[model samples]
Target: MSAVAGKAAERVAQEVPAVQFRPKKIRTVAYASAALLVVVFAVVGWLLGDTPTGVIFRTSDQIAMALLGVVLAGAVLLLARPRVRADAEGVEVRNPVTSYKFAWADVLKVSFPDGAPWARLEFPEDEYVSIMAVQAVDREHAVAAVRALRELHKAATR
Candidate 1:
């Protein structure tokens, strides 16, 4: 490549902002919640183990409860895991059940409205995507994340 072309490539690369957001605080909570669920199930099993019911029934009951605990823990962990990433080209959002990607030009606005559960990215045609990673539960951290994304959006649009 020519020297001028190389310099232009470098400039373009430098202009692309690297921004990432994730539900760190919520993940911690998820871990704790899963642990609590396990403990509660254990306690319940112990308490019910000595019941006068037949051994087969008791065993099946305990097994069912154990399976339920595992399922619930897994669900909690997955639901709380969210991430958002943006570069000069576009943004990606990862929620519990789905992921989406959007070009910077398509993003019209970013908002974290008062009393809302999480932030959102508005696009044209009145459509929007939820940002589960920037949650209200994280409070200040969530706000900072939304602000950083908005700033990046402005710079990219410019």
Candidate 2:
């Protein structure tokens, strides 16, 4: 084989390692927002002394308000839960409310179309799995992840 051809073959032979992808900015924002919400709710609840109708706010009421804030914060944290894990064996996509696992053979391609919010794994029969972890907002990070995933898919399919 020619030297150039041999080097290209060697490059292809190098295995793509397992990787996990998650939205960076979104996760940071989610965590900060959750903390802020909890603190604000707790402070407001504690400062609640009397209602406009002369009804006094009890300790239990304060606790309940704080707890409500915690609950809301938990909901906000869900936005940070999306993740994608890929390896030689397969890929797993975990969206905010759903999860999917697919072997490399099952995925036809990794695609991020123009104006798409996130990447997706296309399959046979027009089905596809959205990869929320690789979001458009992440820009270069998302591009690299999709490229790595495509390389893995290419190698596995061969």
Candidate 3:
């Protein structure tokens, strides 16, 4: 490349910041789901075990119920894992299968939903993106990311 062209390229590269990934940690969903599973298991166990007609339920049946309880608990814990990250360049929202990258300029809005396990973002194109991983497990982290992103946006503009 010519020296002038190379210098121009270097200048452009320096102007655009690099992306930094800050993963979202959402704990509430994970813990709450496990709790719900435990409650269900307890109710089922009581009905299946100590009831007066106990002979009908049997020990083997209880074991099967316990196994089901375990599976439910595991599911809840897995669902509670965080999946959101953000950095200097932009925000990255990830679900189990898909991930989207939005630069500070593209992010139009960030909304924290009440009684929901994820945060949603609206883009300039009018499409919606979910930062569910973080919302599911660490909402405070998600909020902090949004705040950080706002600052990043301001810096980029200036």
Candidate 4:
């Protein structure tokens, strides 16, 4: 390659910034709701009296109920786990229960369709990976993340 072309390529590579993205509104809501659920459940368990059939509610039963609430809160907190990391080399997308990593060559584009819940990384053969971290509820933040990822993909592929 020509010297100017090499310099331009180097510049482009240097311009690619590493980024980590996470849903703002969803994460905040998830944390708040989880905390609230745990508190409510624990309070109810502690104050629980007897059953309608006159069966007494034992301390063990109360403890078990509190534990159940903790478990449920943990499950609810999973909604905040989605994240995306991207750089010039590739991107990593982590949804609630699944994760995907793709090199620039494997990613054809970054798209956020109208009325979609989140952004996505397009691949060959019409395949794509959803990026839940960049959620529609985040609005401008999601748009900026998608644009940054697209720019990184372009620079890497070029």
lDDT of 3: 0.62
lDDT of each: 0.81, 0.88, 0.62, 0.87
Superposed model 3: Cα runs more than 4 Å off: 1-29, 32-36, 39-50, 95-118, 133-143, 153-158
lDDT of 1 by residue, 42-93 (tens): 6676666776776544777787777778788888889676999986666899
- The candidate maximizing TM-score is 4
Comparing 1 and 4 on lDDT, the stronger one: 4
Q: How displaced is residue 52 in candidate 4, in Å?
A: 6.7
- Give model 4's TM-score versus the native structure: 0.89
Clashing residue pairs in candidate 4 (N, C-alpha, C atoms within 3 angstroms): none
Q: What is the lDDT of candidate 4?
A: 0.87
lDDT of 3 by residue, 1-158 (tens): 58965565455446544433333343555677777877788678667877776468877787777678878888767654435555444567766557787765577766666876666777666688876654534556656755655555555434
lDDT: worst 10-residue window of model 2: 5-14
Clashing pairs in 3: 24-84, 25-138, 26-137, 26-138, 27-137, 27-138, 83-133
Candidate order by decreasing TM-score: 4, 2, 1, 3
Give per-model TM-scores.
Answer: 0.81, 0.87, 0.53, 0.89
Select the stronger candidate by lDDT from 3 and 4: 4
In model 1, what is the error at residue 51, expressed in angstroms?
Answer: 0.8
Candidate order by decreasing lDDT: 2, 4, 1, 3
